[model samples]
Target: MSTKYKFHEPTAIYFISFAVVGWIDVFTRTVYRDLLLESLSYCRKEKGLNLHAWIIMSNHVHLIISSKEGYLLPNIMRDLKKYSSYRILKEIRENTMESRKEWMLYLFSKAGQQNSNNKNFQFWRQDNHPIELDPHLNMFEERIDYLHNNPVEAGLVANAADYLYSSAIDYEGGKGLIDIDVLI
Candidate 1:
């Protein structure tokens, strides 16, 4: 991971993007997607991760996140990604319903082999591409809108609020998979 994508201002909200290696669509499975949701929820409640906005796509996740309990933003994001990677790999390995298990594992294993930082498998990529959000400049709203409309732009849904894995519903005043503080 390069220092350019790191979290520098601890209290500043940042829009970050993290994706699976090779841009694999590993999150097509509900199990893998739900694992990320669960981890995010846990981080919000227990780890003081303040999630302003979030969206989980097929293989990537976007977030408007910040520290609430004085935890460093980078550390919190690192923990979330680390825990989710472990659990998701475990789920993939153990899931009998997974048709692409062997291939996916092979790819992940190969990726891990290419990086000494990983012992066996690697899921999420190292770079977060954190961009500090400036609310005054309308950057914050711009990001939130882009995140909500991602699924729509991808043809996954006709409307942003209809995407089950996104915070668009929360922004629409409807309950979503996880609780969020709407920023847009």
Candidate 2:
């Protein structure tokens, strides 16, 4: 409801970050992460999502993105989160090998019940802090540094480019998991 964090300029590239409810480490498994990757791929191909940079951590995701022609960033993000949540929840529900299945589901269900907007489960938290970047300010390099260095800062990888779930590889002149309109 706050305009402060809302996506205002549809054509402006924005830095957005969203977290899993309760900061749950849902992306620890390959399946859950892959589900999100697939959704991002679909958004890029069909929803006109022009991804500049992105990184998916254990509990949250950060993206620098804009939209092509008629698409809106907020709408694309909404669809991405909604579809990915459904896919992730289904996989969690059906995965007999998931050790944290019951606990994760309980948390998601509780979060859903607490929020009036959700009917069943709330995998992703509602607010996506979107900051429209000002090109004149030259913020892309700083933001991209922060985004790419996340895995290294978290001690997940020795080098930022070593992290497979990020666009840092692309910035380092290598192909990443998904296509991106590299800014650097």
- Residue range 1-184, candidate 2, lDDT tens digits: 5688998887899999999999999999999999999999999999999999999999999999999999998899999999999999999999999999999999999999999999999999999999988888889998999999999999999999999999999999999999999986
Clashing pairs in 1: none
Model 1 lDDT tens row, 1-184 = 4577777888898999999998999989888999999999999999989999999899899999988866888788889999999999999999998999999999999999999999999888889999998878999889999998999999999999999999888988899988887776
CA deviation > 4 Å runs, candidate 1: none
Superposing all C-alpha atoms, what RMSD in Å does each candidate have to the true structure? 1.1, 0.7
On lDDT, the candidate that comes out on top is 2
